[model samples]
Target: MTSTNKESNGSPSPSDSSKGLWRNLQFARMFIAYALATFGDWFDALAIQVMVAYRWGADPLIIALIPVCMAVPGILLGSVAGTLADRFHKVRIMLLCDVITVVLTIAILFAPNAIWLLPLLTLRAMMGVFHIPAQQALTRQVVSEEHLFQASSLNGFVAQCSKVAGPLLGAVILAVFSPQFCIVINACTRLISGLVLWPLRKLVQPKQWEGKGLTGQTRTETESVLTQWVRGWSFIRSRRIILTTMLFGCFGLLAILMIDYQFTTLFRAIKPGNESLLGWLASSVGAGAVVVILLLNRLPQIGYGWGLGGGFSFIGIGIAALGWVTPLTPEIWVIVWGLCIGIGNGLSMVTMNYLLQKETPPAFVGRVFGIQNSLSSIVLVVAPLVGGILIRSAGPSPAFQYIGMATFMIGIVGIVLQRVLWAEKKSPVAALQE
Candidate 1:
């Protein structure tokens, strides 16, 4: 592959230099399935938070447990999930995940009290831990290297867009039906995503699933999961591009998650009973992401260090600004500030991911991303709990300020990583390598 894919970046992969507006049919199908599933997840997210806060009378600490419960399993089990994704048929893994999700969503409907929400959400999150690595690995396998950047960008945009659409859909649902019904709607969407993937069954199988190497040899594959796990971890440790960006991105993820778990609280703090305002604030993020997605080809053609560090710095500024300016101070200020956060999220996340994908091989994609996801979960797991406590003790306004500052600190970390990478560039071997 070339250094840049002109369709998404400024150039193209060596294999397919021609430009195209859409990924091939196979990738397109997967996108549809994924988008449907992501929308469901967003809807469930909004419903759960609203239910926990309004229906359960959950304090910030208790509500914080919801995201914590969902994330902790990723930290604990993501390695296994990533390895399994490589070993198994990714399509089957995705299908099974959806099936399990449907079952779990129904289980939530029958849950006797809000206490059950955490455990159920945790199970669903774990299922996702398996599904996501597989999907990422599978996408790399199926999509052309030339199209990967655009495909990844489009997929990322879809996921973020769902965050906008799902919450808005949830707002409408809550307006008409009980929050419990949102769980049911989510379950149905999961089923839809699975059904959509059914057509790819015969075509989506990779060599790894057939007990062979990616190159189609009856290779002596590592017999032990432990060995595979170690290889994966070792790969993550060795790649400065992956390792540093993963660590730096944590701050942005933390800031975003804090806002995620605390959105209702933030909105209510501004104006209680303004249920739809949360959607409006959340939608602004999608708006910002849309701007970047639309301008995908126009982004500065820079090296990974500059692209990732500068992008993260931008995200940090936006997030910190949002935290510093609480909603109640001025509603328009909060809404407009959300656009900044979203734009940062889009630019930083897309750039970092593209860099990671460019560096990762098909064989290691699952494990590398698995480690990345797990590392991210470390922040995701802790941010909500700490944010809850902060919200309770410091109130949403100050709590938000703290989250924003934490995110801003990540920008500093990114700059340092960029400098270190630039210094390493003098070494021809590593700099010359992918």
Candidate 2:
């Protein structure tokens, strides 16, 4: 195995330096399965919102609870999910989660009221908390180290594509059919994803645990779950690169998420009656992401630090530009701003995944990602409310400008700190000898 120091510094792994990502058949299959599952998830997401807000005529607070239901499970159970990913067979966990999700999604059609729908939605989201860590762990296993960035870029591309296509498809279906029909389609997608992944159970065998944790710490089979979970946090703290990357990434995410939910409100102020322009702006973001992913994939290698810092800076600038979107502003420029934000999203996501996978050992990767997810979920829960408050008190334009500038400064700090934070660390033996 390549040393963590080498990989963390963006050096190509010796294992698969020459192998192209497209040539890896296992990754191709996994990509297809992930695309299907992610696309299906968006369908369910849009359908559920429509069901709650329109079909059920739910109040604003009740509608707000929908996202809360989805996010809270990750906040509560992410560590446990990550631990399971480390201990169990990842393929099996993904398969089981898919099956359970399919059942729950189908059951959603029969939900008589908001009370029943909320719990079912929460359970389905809980399945995702387990599924994500397992899928991420599985990605580390299937892809060689050198191609991790390309693989992560491709995954982000699929997600962005789904974010655009899924809702458009759901909207079209809802126009002709019903949200329940869309839910049924989601169930089918999960079922097919399970079927596609089922073959991997035989082809990709699980490695036996060596009962070793990070940095030569013991992680015996007899250890308690809490102990292992605590160890995961310890491992992160001990690795400065991983800890810094995760913290800075989450900080950028906080800034972005704070403004994410306010875009529509901003649009409303800029143009009162044009609803379709919002959709076009969203599609522009997806288009921007797609462009960046394609560009990154063509590169032989990428510097994780540059990707992270540049991406956040681009995002901050894009958000700040929105402040200029007055009634006199051209709609095309607004879309261009959205595209800029998308570009930043693409850069950050690919590098973030690559950094985490490269720095974390397979044994701890699940826990690492699990904790990352939990932290993100916390931001997801809080950031939107803060964004709302800021918009209401400061107004959208001023709030956007201030928040955007703060975020831009964060990116600058990340760039300045990257050299110190990501410098290759001395090995234990070398340190002891010195």
Candidate 3:
């Protein structure tokens, strides 16, 4: 197997690399298309919630099922999607998924009731499950190693901006127009993303498959999708750096997910009359993420340990402070805490992407992300239920404190483990190649 350094002199300086990354037409196209698609996703997400809770008058249990519908596809088909991303041309997969999503988003507009909407939502989410891994894999193909962190930071920035902007725009549209209108807007964005990406079919050429397959055979023959799917999990397990980061990352996720949804309840307790502040509070988190993404882009380097550990710690501290909010507590303080968590969120995400690209061989990048998504789905399903029970019985105050501390500890432990486990500079891609 041959690994060509895309940048001259083995590694280009950070400033040069950043400029090159922006100049790369493939990355530029992807960035614009991804931003449009992500904004549309968040817009439709808010639209769906309003449609179910307000329009259809869904009960709490039914409303809770919304996330379950979205998550179930990732749990079931995520790894399979990854295998498909690895087996086929990733650009084609991304383009196909975008087109399918455009169709499904339009179909969502016609659903008269929650029953019909749920299935369409699930199918749309399934397309996302396929789209994400393909996008991540393609990113590895286009961005050189020197510029990966910048690319990751830029992507995170787009996502954070979309999170803030999409819901706000959706709210405005929903007030002036209708949920169906918002759904239509989402469909148009998807269509636009597809059109933007269509030209990449002729432009970005993927590296030829040069290494042995994960099943210990040459890439001359195709492996069954099921075999690749199963091997994806084992492949992660075989690499210590990937496995450790993934496990600890999920731990942090469990801690965050537990308290994330309960913020509304907490806000209600602190300031019962102004549930509207919740929007500001949520936007604050996105603001924090954007700040951190910008900071990361300016930095010459990012340490994986610092990104994961510091991220966990910041979020943990913020969440813990958030638990202490009382009627007497100032609203400004709460927004500050939310901002802290957002910074951590951005840091961890960018680091995770950077690590995956740095460590995983090109052959297995898609499967790695797919397996990660599946694991996250498991945490997503379990965390909310447990958090709800804890909050119901113990109240949000104690629940936040406990969960926040646990999250903080996860970060501290991650740092200590990184020191021990990564004492040697291990090259997972090189090891896999051998």
Candidate 4:
């Protein structure tokens, strides 16, 4: 690793180094496992959606149910998953989920009836509900606190890479093979992911909490799932900044979902003869995310300031591009929207993950992230249905315009709040303490 330094207030600052990606062997294992798992996830999603659309002649409305099914589980089971992550050895939970998912995928391959499709998809989604929080919690356990930001950035980068490659590979596989075969391949990926994760069992040591004897037993027995679900909100009540960030995230998620629907519909409208355009557009978005991730790792200072601002700007521009859709040049508009939204999502996701890791204690990180995931899932569920209704009545252009306007308002609010916080830091009372 190389080294550098910063000086502040006549004090010598710590030197910077490469952060030595290989320092945490267990973290690397987890990253590889997650990347492989995501590849399978993305592949299954794209392949199944296309298969259903082609074989069953399903429209966008029906296909939208696929995402809805996946998100529904997160909304319902996220808190439970978080609680489990906190209580158990997270690696064990993750490995178990992986095995369950693989079995479910194999079952889907063997029983390939349209009637069985929804149930199989729902089961897969349920496995994901457990897998995500466990994986996140285990990552924290494996790496040092100082390396968390970079680890998160790298994880985001790998996941985006999977998104880019998975769909394209899936499309190819579908051209030559059946959807059942794709399901089998997805199972194979999960199996390999599980194998990779098996070696990290030692890293996730279980915590031993001191018991309060009968009082603890009584409280445990009396606690309900609803109480656990609301615990995240209670924790966030005092964290004004994080709460505001989550609110911004909700708008960002809404904008992203709107663009997703618009992209699919627009591609179908513009080049209905060539469905490959949808995959290409999705790949473009993934490419943009990859670019942002790389830049963030290479340029930390810029990532902390302008990179964050640029991300929100990209989101605003992306939403505006969606509103500009015209039949005359829809492809160009789709690409532009993909680029902007991709960059925006990449920047926002990495920064938010970093902030959460920095501010939250290890014991509560899982619950906090679970809440964030659930909130995003809820927004996603509502966005498509509402977007579909708007498109039906007002037309796609106006629907997109409405989404864009709302996103821009949220971004403005975030910027204003940031400035207020900055001003407070610069005030005389704050300065005197310094």
* Best prediction by TM-score: 3
TM-score of 2: 0.92
TM-score of 4: 0.82
TM-score of 3: 0.93
The segments of candidate 2 whose C-alpha lies over 4 angstroms from its true place after superposition are: 1-19, 203-209, 425-434
Candidate 3 local distance difference test against the native: 0.83
Give per-residue CA lDDT, model 1, range 120-191, as digits (tens). 888989999999898898777776555667777787788788877888888799889988888889999999
lDDT of 2 by residue, 131-205 (tens): 999989888776776687788888988998999999999999988998999999999998999988876765443
Q: On residues 89-115, what C-alpha lDDT tens digit does candidate 3 reach at each position?
A: 788899999999988898888888888
TM-score, per-candidate, Cα-based: 0.81, 0.92, 0.93, 0.82
Q: Which ten residues in a row have the lowest lDDT in candidate 1?
A: 3-12
Tens digit of per-residue lDDT, candidate 4, span 14-99? 22224454545566678889989999998877667766888777766667677777788888877777766655667888899999
Error of 1 at 257 (Å): 4.3
In angstroms, the error of model 4 at 202 is: 2.5
Q: What is the C-alpha RMSD of each candidate to the true structure, in Å?
A: 5.9, 4.9, 3.9, 7.1
Each model's C-alpha lDDT? 0.71, 0.83, 0.83, 0.68
